[model samples]
Target: MNEIWIEKYRPRSLKDVVGQKDIVDRLQSYVTAKNLPHLMFAGPAGTGKTTSAIALARELYADSWKGNFNELNASDERGIDVVRGKIKEFARTAPIGGADFKIIFLDEADALTSDAQAALRRTMERYSRTCRFILSCNFSSRIIEPIQSRCAVFRFRPLRPEDIKKNLGQIAAAEMLSIEDDALDALVHVSQGDMRKAVNSLQVAASLGEKITVELVYHTTGMARPEEVKQLLEVALSGEFIAARNRLDDIMISYGLSGEDILKQIHRTVFELDIPDYEKVRLVDRTGEIEFRIVEGSNERIQLESLLAYLALVGENRADSAD
Candidate 1:
């Protein structure tokens, strides 16, 4: 807790988790039954998939949780060979107590290859008597159907704004950092439902000074302030191509944003612009095309520079047509 907040502040029990109430209630029922089938947790990053897995293990195993709880990240484990090897090792022994089975938590499980997942599915069947598996993944669609059918899938939603704010307030009180009301709101907005990001931002901002402000939050996260992004779009729409290009370069270079990151901001900011509705739609569609190219490994700086020029053209067209 002294060194890092995310790990230190991670929820230890089901009740401690902030959101996903229905899933928590279901998990609590599993605890009461003293039995669990395979579980698949599907959601975006920074939600409580991993946390719920650990909390369930703790609830089930009491004093001997660590020995019975085995955690493996499928993204790092790579191939079927490694997966089989680790499962064999963990499942070899009976659980330490009279409990019916041990638990293996495979995090980021959607990263596994088809072959690897097929092998893992077999492993799950073979060990059904003595072991249970809980898989956590960002997207459940990638998980094979055989594996899906075996598990009770739970979809985790991103934390609500109030949930994030409550956690931030507790951490600030505990850590004794001074964060303003608006600054806290900004943190929540930037996190986009990721509690891990919100907590990390607070910790990073705290490192710079005792008083954490909105400016510090934006600077520490390397995100262009919303207004800066809005202004960049405004400049481009006003037909100042060179200045807008320079500003875009500064934002990407100074803020460490990928082309995708900058374009996402542009897409959102477009809706807030004074431009006509049809033109707003056109810019957003163009942003999507460029973003796809960047994702396919195009040169980011060149693509973004060209995008500014396109905006300049759109502005001129808007002026020339003169509705």
Candidate 2:
């Protein structure tokens, strides 16, 4: 069976991990000292929180990494029971290879309930001698201050475009895939600094054919082409409300995109529009309102059409002022 490229190409060592240079350097220091405090990795998704935890364990434990490291997703069982049961059991165990302490990596730790986090904080305090905890969460604020104070916090930043491109380029060369330059750009744009998304999109595109094009990247990823999104906005900005609505319908149906997806694309395309900054700001503000309405269960089609109408109004006012 062909392995998932994300897993196949995951950075095995701190040196192999891309981006988060500061975090990686700090982790290396802990490994050099063979000592670790309870750690909290706070960051956005796919920014190497989990990967960094796993890599730290491997470096610290070497051949015994698997035996000493326990991985759990707090989101799966976010109640106090897990903290009292499985976690307590594992945390009290002695390291198998004479290591100072075992590591427990809790992913999505912010998902834990108040009671569970309270229990977890106590557990970390009690297990400091026998085990160390690495907690990963998208939002550190959701974690109780007590737990936050107990751990050395590392904040990870989103990957840069060049970093993502370099990693993808290496993966492509290794996989012997031929990808067009525009296809690579499409992947980067679609990924929005998420390495996992970028790699998975590339893998999906590669499966469809040997040579990946812009169309393949966008089609496989279920994203409308940027140019198409820009065209929709341009049509609306020219006061062609009906024409813009028709184009909007085409883009949504063609990509099977959700209302939020189309709205997000439109929002991104707005700043790039040739209109003045004030118009762009108004369009962006209106897009946010439409997005909020859609998220609140408003009818997507009506909400989207209303946005196009507003765009037409903005366009008309701009023309009148020019005259």
Candidate 3:
């Protein structure tokens, strides 16, 4: 059995891809023409950006795709010199297999420095006849305007719940297990639309050799159960300071979640609470501040604990005011 479902089931052709149908259709047009222009794929991680780029190359070059396609992660290289060096080396030889231009798929292209992007723009122009560039990043805004204008840009959204559900269902059946209803719900909720994460969590649960259940999925994925998160809100909002603090600790320690991670989930959880919209906005504002502090190197535990305390007070004051 293949250990890594991600690689085992990665889409080989554009049609095999899960969602993002409009982007797939546009890419297929290029495949039919056998002519790909410089392209940019912008989206969150695990959304099939790199997969689409590779699949396009495979469809275009057939058996010789391996020789003609180059893959690079801009984050791995320390500087633009490395990018320039690699591009020079790859372009030294004409594309193999009678293809018009070789392809260099640069993953995390936004990580490249501004100076690097500038150099890259020139590089793309210099090698337009010999190579095409496919840049993928989470934020297209980070990429320079010149680079953005040069290529066909495709924006990828998070996979829909149905898309994730159908794919995971197929994978679960293939593994020959009876998936509990809650397992799929927990998996989708925890994954937050990252298909890679959803598939990976499913694989981890299957490795335990037991029926996949909600608790097991949460344990395997190191995620706090939605109910637990809800309860945390309940405890905090009800002004149970010690209990709320302890619950926060349990979630953080048990799940190995960072402060920012917990805070972001709390923000999501706040919206689900049966609180007034005004109270929800207040809690979200506090969460936003703490998240920033955690990211900016403020002490994680201290900051989050403070936020919980504030929520407790807010919940109390709001409850009393309603009376």
Candidate 4:
């Protein structure tokens, strides 16, 4: 529904799209002139590329925007037929309310195959005067060279931590939620520079009531509690191989901590440990190899156990060398 936080909080205009100043500036130029070129918006997920494209349409057409905009997802529709048919239907119709050209927004355009993209290139050229295409994708490299050449490419960067915090604060105030500074920081860290995720997390936390804490976000993201993960690492570093393996099994069973996630926590915890530089480097290298092997279809529990064994050895080695 339109009342959903993500949709409800969607930016209505260029200024509302956060953390993309340069892209906004270039897009503003097109809106000001009322004559936009074909555009390719490339960026990571939830970073406002689709939202910016919609905002641009809203600005350019004002009240008549709906009639002048056509939005489609290349990945959802599949193949070139749908794209060609939609482009023909939309481009054939003149801009509503006497506007010079209509706008077609293609989300996830990079999903189209090379052959489909070639067909899209022809359609783009044919409709250049009557319709402007705004293509959105996670990666620009996947788009065919010919289509990329025809469009003005705007790269959207992930929102910075400060930007995420600022926007989250605004949303929190609007929703009448009280939050602590540390909790907010935790949300930002988990979001990893994604404003949409931050907002969504805040909305979920707000829905539960006023007392939102960092642990709430940690649970929301399905990550094992930091304390629990820390405990597992500490036990492993104690050099009691059997006890360490038992603790790992308990963690995996109780909290569903996957091999990949355990590896990430181990990576983070390694830096915080009092180990020497060379030893830290060696541990990290081994951790990386285990991570890669886990990803490459090695049994998760087996690979992780092997990793824990290595950690135990390293901890014992370090303790002995220190002695």
Q: What is the C-alpha lDDT of each candidate?
A: 0.90, 0.93, 0.88, 0.84
TM-score of 4: 0.90
Question: Which regions of candidate 4 fall more than 4 Å away from where they truly are?
Answer: 225-231, 234-255, 264-281
Instruction: List TM-score per model, in order.
Output: 0.93, 0.98, 0.93, 0.90
Model 1 C-alpha lDDT per residue in residues 1-323, reported as the tens digit of each score: 36889999999999898888999999999999999999999998998999999999999999899989999999998688966898767876699977789999999999999989998999999888889999999999999999999999999999999999999999999989899987898898789999999999999999998788998998888788888999998899888999999898888888888888888888878888988899878888889889988999999888888889999999888878886
Full-model lDDT, candidate 2: 0.93
Q: Candidate 2 lDDT, tens digit per residue, 1-323?
A: 17899999998999888999999999999999999899999988989998999899999999999999999999898999999999999999899988999999999999999999999999999989999999999999999999999999999988999999899999999988898889889999999988999999999999988888999999899999999999998898899999999999899998999999888898888888888888788888899999999999999999999999998998898899999
Winner on lDDT between 1 and 3 is: 1
What order do candidates take by lDDT, descending?
2, 1, 3, 4
Name the top TM-score candidate: 2
Off by over 4 Å in 1: 253-258, 296-298
Model 2: which residue pairs collide? none
Top lDDT model: 2
Q: For model 3, where is the 10-residue window of minimal lDDT?
A: 78-87
Model 4 Cα shift for residue 67 (angstroms):
1.0
Better of 3 and 4 by lDDT: 3
Query: In candidate 4, what are the lDDT values of residues 8-53, reduced to their tens digit?
Result: 8899999989999988988899888989789999988889988999
Cα RMSD of all models vs. native, in order, equals 1.9, 1.0, 1.9, 2.5
